[model samples]
Target: MQIQDLPYPDPGVPDAHSGPRFLWWLGRNQLGGQLKSLAWGLLHFTSVTGLPFCVGFAIQAVVDRSGARLALSGGLLALCGMLIALGDTFLHRAAVTNWITAAARVQQLLARKTAQLGSALTRRVAAGEIVAVSTGDVEKIGWFVEAVSRFTAAALSVVFVCVALVVYQPALGIVVAVGVPILALAVLPLLPRATRRADFQREKAGRATELASDTVAGLRVLRGIGGEELFLDRYRAASQEVRHAAVRSARMWALISGIQVLLPGLLLITVVWYGVGLARDDRITIGELVTVYSAVMLLSYPLRHFEEIAMAYSFSRPSAKRAARVLSLERATDTAGSLDASVPSGDMHDPATGLLVPAGRLTAVVCGDPDAAGRLAERLGGHAAEEASSDTSVRLGGVPLDELPLDSARTAVLVQDKDPVLLSGTLRELLDVPGSGDITPEEALAAAQCGDVLEALIQGSLDAADPMDARITERGRSLSGGQRQRLALARSLITDPEVLVLDEPTSAVDSHTEARIADGIRSLREGRTTVVFTSSPLLLDLADRVVLVHEGEVAAVGAHRELVHGEPRYRAVVTRETDEEAAASLGEVLDGGVVEGGLRDGVRDGGAAKHDPPKKDSHQSHGSKHGKPTLSDVLNELEEIEETA
Candidate 1:
């Protein structure tokens, strides 16, 4: 595909064994682009090298007083100039295309990997490291990729110039050949130092970026706990460290640049001085001497490419390595499978937990531990199972999920984590996802209770557009927790996967709203198989079967009401605490014997007589049996009596 057709249909599998190998693999994929770039680059540099020869010949023709030869040299010079202009124009186009396409391909690969790994990707790699790789590191890798063609052309042109000079005049040729090699090699020792400094600067910058990311992600939490200043100070220090490292890295590059310039200039001076001596000694003609000097001057131009190529390699090597590292991370469930087989529609069973979710039924999983619940949901979706000690695996339709094609497994079961992120875009764009197309966006939104959310997006929008066209800020920061949850749920519902697993899908919403969302899920997904990992009674009550998972084992499996009554462990996890117990604990915390006379009767008697009998003690209180008076109520009654007196 052409560069314009970017975000390639497939980025192709990457060789992620090492950074250098990854880079080489990328080069091989874009061989055509690289070849075009090299051809244009060669044409450009060759004309530039030939320009000096034409000038020297013109000088000789002028010295001979031959108008014909002078005109010939002048015409040849103009032709070389025209070729240089033509070649340079297309050279940039080809080279930049290579750079952009390479970057786009890598971005696509990273995006695919991220989607494949899901929430587990961040756990394996720092969010900061990923940000660095996708953003800054991608460009660095592309920079090296594009630089290779230009460097190759420049080196070839320099070699051609040195050979022609030696054939024409050996005395000057030998000096130039020796000096050019020295000029290229002069900064080799210093390159290692510059690369180290650059790496340090990149590290500091990544740290600062990560700190800023964490701060922004938890801004609301920081404000709530008044830790904003503490983190702000930490980020400030990180930024300062980055600045210092950048300055040091820049200094090293500057010193290297200076050395490159000094050596080339020294060689030019030596060539000019030596050529003049040859002219005086009558060993070479004045035009030949002029040609030697002009050629040396031209050599300086391509020689600088050496320094540029060095810098590119130093930066790109590290970037490529990081990209490779991320690509190498595979799902624990990753295994071989035949592409020809169709995915089955059988029950999903996790052997580790011995939990079976029958096909075409809504199953509720109640796990006391939130972390364990999340892991279980991911396992059902064929995600991570790294620590499993058994040879058996999670199976769907009687086949191990790991042995199925990745895309097939993903399409069959979609596990929505506890907190799904909402990317910034218009409402329409946010909900536009690849799916079975069985459910419309409007239907999904209604099922997810997102009518209020849609209205709010439209009202808060700065632009005048249709309600669905209203834009959402990054991560839906403009929306409340419940609104974000509803919107994310809507997006997930629309996907219409065969086996949908939801982890606390309505935890952020109120009980009333949660009840509505639970109904919506059950009704909309009536015929589909779904597994919801939650302890909410509102949701569990609707499930066809509820599985009580305690300490990584299925303790009980039955209807919600049956489990709540028969299994004490399930009751404790779902109810948090019984109403009577909670009320007794709260009643005991009251003062002035309210717990003894009023609260105990109110809760235990289940709405007893209005008034409690007056107690004998001076500090004893009397109030409605169902409603105990608080300290503020007593204070207000006393104030009213004093005013009346």
Candidate 2:
């Protein structure tokens, strides 16, 4: 592929066994690009090495005092210069292309891994470290990949120059050729110390970067706690350590550079000393002597590629290792599960919690503890905890959800957490996710009560754009909390999954909108199984059945009205009514009024002074059939301790 066709269609599964292995894999995959760079690099360096020969030929022509030879030699010199310029230009372009493509491929791989792992990736790895790997480490790896090909070309050119010189003037060419390799390899001893110092410096700098990031992220907290100056002091100390380490690292590289210059200068002196003796004895001419000296000077430039390659390897090794570690990560949910247990079409059961949600019904679960609700929702969707494999809790159609492949399980169950994120995109793109296509976009939007959201999106645009085409910023930060919630709900509704789990789907909206949303959810998903974890009375009253989860397990299951009168814990969770408040209230509900103690001061029971039950089914949502007053009369507002569940 060409350089422009970057971000490979498939980044391919990596070796990921070790840092070196990962780096090698990257190199092998990009061999085509590397070879392109190598070809251009050969042209550039070979032309450069041939320049000394052109200079030697021109000098001989001038010494001969022949105009024809002088003109011909000058022409050759200019042609060689032209070739050097053309080669250098293309070589650099090709090398930089290699660098960019390598980085893009690595980024794509990391992104795919993150998508596969979902939220589990963040739990297993530090977010800052992940960012550092994608940013700085990726660049380091690309640098090494691009550097390798150039180093190879430079080495090859040096070999050519060595052979040419030895054949041209064996007496003096041998010394210069042998000395060139010595100068190139002379820095090998210093490289270990230099690499160690560089690693130390990088470590210190990374600490400094992380410290600054943490301090800034928590700056508001630090200021509130009156510890801003303390953090500033700590940051200053980290900065100083980084500076010291950088200076130490720079000093080691400077020593290597000094040796490079000094040794080559000594070799030059030796060649000149011997060349002068030969010329005085008329054994070799001035032009040959100049060629030998100039060739050494030209070879010195490419020789630096050796040190550069070594340094590049030292730095990129650790970066490759970090990338491999992230790529190799596997969540417990990512297992080779049974293909036969693919799509769920029956009742969903959680044996561990004793909760069975009948298919084709809306089941509302009232769990007082937010953590328990979250865990249950994830389990219902066939997701495992970040640290370990999930237990045999949830099953679909009598088959364990975990026993099904992740893709099949995810396709079967869609779980929208309390805080559903709205990614940056047009409404059309956002809703264009995997779905059965049974629900239209307009139907989903209406069911989600997003008319006002659609209006805001259109109005917020600079032009009179279509509502579906209007863009939402990242995470919908530009929209209100309720607007984001409704938008996310609409997208989920559009998917129309086999089974859906929504945790506090309407927490951010007002009471009237929440009621409408409840009705919308009921109508929109008439035949699909949906489990809503919420404390809202409006939604609970509309569920086909209400399941009360207490202490992380199902405590009671019944119609909304039955649970309200029969279970005190259920009343406490949904009505926000405390046990003390219940103790101070009138006795057991009696046909609308308190039976023994009579009605509490203002309590009116849907004016029901007679017993009534659902005409066809007593266990059905009493709120839907018995009217709101029977349940609303005793209902109280739940404590708003958590903004979301």
Candidate 3:
């Protein structure tokens, strides 16, 4: 049958049934082409069978002194040879077309299923397994499907040849017919073992691919922590395991190959032995004996197909099962009712922590643990945790988050993550998310405090004209960390959802930039329900109110200043600049103490009453005299500490 006529297997069927059922389904769908190809192949096999008969006829004609019959038989044999060659060529062409089209259809189905699952696909299946299915599995499935037509044609040709032999010489024909089936069926028992080994080899290969992908993605982190050697050693071990599996698979195939060759050779020998006896007994003429022998020799070619089909199936079955598994992944769903036509209009609530973000107001979430804040954000955005006991329930307008239609829910509540994904695109294109409407690029950039980001774009020789059109590389690798974060923020602002949820939007920028972003966000997101999940003091101060999260629950809720004084955890979490800042501050305190001691020593040694002439000081004089030392002064003290050490 033509490959175009083959139907792709239904993805909903059980994987266990996919192998056999898929083959049957393909046959049923492409029956017309298959029958045509088979008919032509049979005619070719008949023409080939006539060759030996014509040769025998010529020999007998020469023996009987009939020159005309000998010449006619010779011409008939030549015509049969040409016809056989033509049939074989056409049959091969049709079969190959069948294979390629079937593979293409299956691949198309796989692509559709992948799109149907969308972002949820990776959560269900390993990315490497998906890669293996599309690249390796599709080809194997097509190989088997295409092999089916060729194999059938070959088997039919062998049958036609054997019948022609039996008609010419009964004794020789019976032997040839029985022996050919034996040769073809002999390899069936060995196939199970070969398929098992092949499955094991494919599994190992998939695992190695997964390990390699993971290694590449985390290579930067591995090098940063000096763990590259450790991961490389692990990958090396995985590679060795893959090699061992491949060797085992090859050994099984080798055994199958040996059987294919030996069985066919033995069948040829049996046919020759029987035909020689018949010729000596004078029951068959010398010419007929030669014809029978020739037919038996031709039958050996198709017998080899039996072994090839077996090997193709052995490799393809496991590949189909792997592809089936990926196609079978179900989309994620919430237990709550369907959310079609639901437009959330009130406060957003997180039941897990008793945190409520009132509608049309700016709210800041201050978490003692950033990890907890991140988890809260994920739940709020409708990404349900696999763990059953994760009792976090987020609601919009008093309706449970799980009840919302996935698309509508996502559109309504946009979660701009701390490390938001910056897909490869122009800056303007990145700002326009999936459902962004008429929001202007300039407004979005301004609201994000992206003036400096635009300046950088201008400085860089990007191919696009406008700063908005400047290309941002994959994952924003081309941009600095802060620039990427700001661009992500701009994208989020453009969406302008009913409830915009941002997790640490200003964490990467400088304090001045952070303040601007904080002010800009509040001004732009005027009437929407906005939840900023951050402990940044600048962002927190801009909020109408701050909710303090501790141990995955809301511990305190009030204004940012109120929480800072009342909640020590909130204060420690936000006010702690960094390790470098702490070290600098400690050095400054020590240096100040040394200076005070030096002044005290001078007073004691000079016998002064530790008094200085009071320089005409007003109310502002004392405050100015004892102003807090700047971070630069602290850094200088730290330099002294380092020098002394």
TM-score of each predicted structure versus truth: 0.85, 0.85, 0.75
Superior by lDDT: candidate 1 or candidate 3? 1
After TM-score superposition, the amount by which residue 23's alpha carbon in candidate 3 deviates from its true location, in angstroms, is: 7.8
Candidate 3 lDDT over residue span 107-183, tens digit each: 77678677555445766777777777788788888788777777787877777777776776778788877887887
lDDT of 2 by residue, 177-212 (tens): 789878988899888888888778777766777677
lDDT of 2 at 92: 94
- Writing each residue's lDDT as its tens digit, candidate 1 over 437-553 gives 999999999999998898898799878468689989999999887799899999999999989999988777655667688999999999899999987666877899999999999
What is the lDDT, from 0 to 100, of the residue 175 in candidate 3?
A: 84
The deviation in Å at residue 8 for candidate 2 is 1.6
* Candidate 1 wrongly placed segments (more than 4 Å): 339-341, 388-392, 424-443, 451-474, 566-568, 578-645
| Model 2's TM-score against the true structure | 0.85
- The TM-score that candidate 3 achieves is 0.75
**Top candidate, metric lDDT:** 1
